[model samples]
Target: MDASSGNSAFNNSVAPLEGFDKDMLSSTLSQTQALLEHFNISDIEKILNMSSRTVSVMTQCYCSGTLREILLSYKSVHGYFSLVVCVFGTLANVLNVAVLTRKEMASAPINRLLTALAIADMLVMLEYVPYACYAYLVLPGEINMPYNWAVFVLFHCHFTQVLHTISIGLTLVLAVWRYIAIRFPQRSHILCSDRRCNVAIGIGYILPLIVCIPSYFTFKIQATVVFENDEMIVLHHVGLSRMAKEDDELLYYVNFWIYGIIIKLLPCVVLTVISCWLIKALYKANRRKQALKGYTNCNSASLLPSEKRAVSKSDRRTDRTTKMLVAVLLLFLITEFPQGILSLLSVILGRCFFRTCYYLFGEIMDILALLNGAINFILYCSMSRQFRTTFALLFKPRMLAKWSTPASQTDVQTTYV
Candidate 1:
């Protein structure tokens, strides 16, 4: 087939040259040719002949012929690693949803958001399990079966994006709600009410589903014929969509601004700013608590026993909840901020950056996100006494009885966050 015909066959895959100026494309190709001069010219030409897109050219030239090998190596390692993590994460998130939704825990508005976050995370892990098995564990030669794995691949791409985007949006809402609670405790009930929280969570899911509609059209399946071992075989794979191929500006906008900015970088930046503000609020609250403690010590005779106890308990609970939430937000920042920066860099530096760095490191980013999804269970168990108590009461009644005192049980019964 000619170059244009071959390109038509795979219109749903990544096509890096769709939006570039002809002169820029020529300069990029020259640079790519010069970079690959050490390799066999015939071999490079043969690969380019298969798909003469910018992605193909850059993979060969910018990656120095190592991208495929690196992908194979990481796929083997992360396939098993990711499977284990996803399974553990899936189960952990299930437990999180269960525990967070219990009557004892459900009263808190924050727990409701946590429950939503856990559900979204669990779906992410569950969806990844089969993908890891098929993409990573299966032998390469056996991958070209009659089954339409490409469709599932397309579904996985959009499915994960939607769920993760929901997770990010919910997290932002969670942070904002916490900040309002901390900053305006008296009006928190009206501001962060259960009805409002549920509405926010609904928007979190709906907005991402809508924003990602454009992404679903960016890829499609294409079948191509090849001769191997003197036999003609048809191989099906994902390619750029017809719209993506025909509209360079749309492709660039979707990949760079929508994926990088709207999906990744914008939320991450907002989360970081909110986290800083939370930390400052926590510091101020701590100072106020210390000052109140000193004043209480000086005026011990003036205050009633009930009032003093109430004041102390309220202060402790608020401080603990704020600190725990800060930890959760920080974990999110640590895992997602690097990805945002890398995504931005990929767009800014063009296809070479994507092929040389971003694509090669994609698996690492996936594993990081999986870890983030999984590790929240550990955080809640470690940081929240109330969560531990509820979990024990539900799953280990005997242990709960063994460990509990009346005062502790009373404390645990009340909503913490």
Candidate 2:
């Protein structure tokens, strides 16, 4: 029976197995043991302190619960929601790429990084659209996918991950660069130069893929035959590799350490720390600006008008850029930090948590990431005046021309970040 149909069976058969009735529990345990043996499910003894037999029974009962049914029910809903979000986000990121890469905007090193980020985010959304359509929109029983399509599915899995990881890396670098620009403006020209930013962006793309290479071996395409509508059909899907199936410890460590710590947890922690530093630096800079303003007012006759205006303009631009980046970093924390924590918890809590909690909520996490990827355009539009002006100039040049004055044109020419 399909998962939805089995909800009733789950309700009736699994609820009683949770109680302390010895006879019923014993019968359920016996059946679970037989099922495990039939399926050749290994590593039960390593998961918990309980006997392998009891663990097997408990795992079976745990999976066959209300939570599973609820997750199953939401599957189609998430699929439809993700599809819409991906479509919108893809277009948004495309716009972001076009706008950020324009000559006026691209002069800023940060904008170049933003351009790379937009490309990565755009690819992520574009790649997910097809997968979402197939996996969620299409009915499983009706799916007659070719074995070769599994290659795309596999590529989709790895590619999205590599891209997302690159996004995370780029974000971290962005934060650090912004911090250096703000905290050490004197050295920023040397430290945050175009060459350095270009190298950083290249590393951001390449390093993540290198780190994710081992993960490519964790799953393989497995083909199976099924009888459908009185006809035999072959279907292919992703399954655990021989190494993954045989070496549970290796899989656990790879997931727990490599994915959980290095990819998710480490980046989240570093970003959080760097974000805090950025905020602190902004505060100090604000105080300095206030002090300088007071001094300028008192010494109005002594200071050159042009020099005073220059200082004020530079300060204002720095403040705006820092504030916008802080918002971006905050959004990243909101979306990514929880996933990192969940990854760690799933590893510690064993397969049940991994399947029930982590795997069940996978789509929700994906949608969150996609939103983060797509929402950058909105953030840039709202927070960065230069971005907005440039966007208008690019797409609505005639409209901009009508409003353009020499002063406003000069303001546009002066880089924002």
The candidate maximizing lDDT is 1
Scanning candidate 1 in windows of ten residues, the lowest lDDT window is: 1-10
Model 1 residue 368 distance off true place after TM-score fit, in angstroms = 0.8
lDDT of 1 at 124: 88
Instruction: Give candidate 2's error at residue 220 in angstroms.
Output: 0.5
User: What's the TM for model 2?
Assistant: 0.81
Model 2 residue 152 lDDT score: 66
Q: State model 1's lDDT.
A: 0.69
lDDT of 2 by residue, 44-99 (tens): 11122244566556556344578756665665476689888889988998899888
Query: What are the lDDT figures for the candidates, one per model?
Result: 0.69, 0.68
CA error at residue 170 for candidate 2, angstroms: 0.7
Q: What's each prediction's TM-score?
A: 0.83, 0.81
TM-score of 1: 0.83
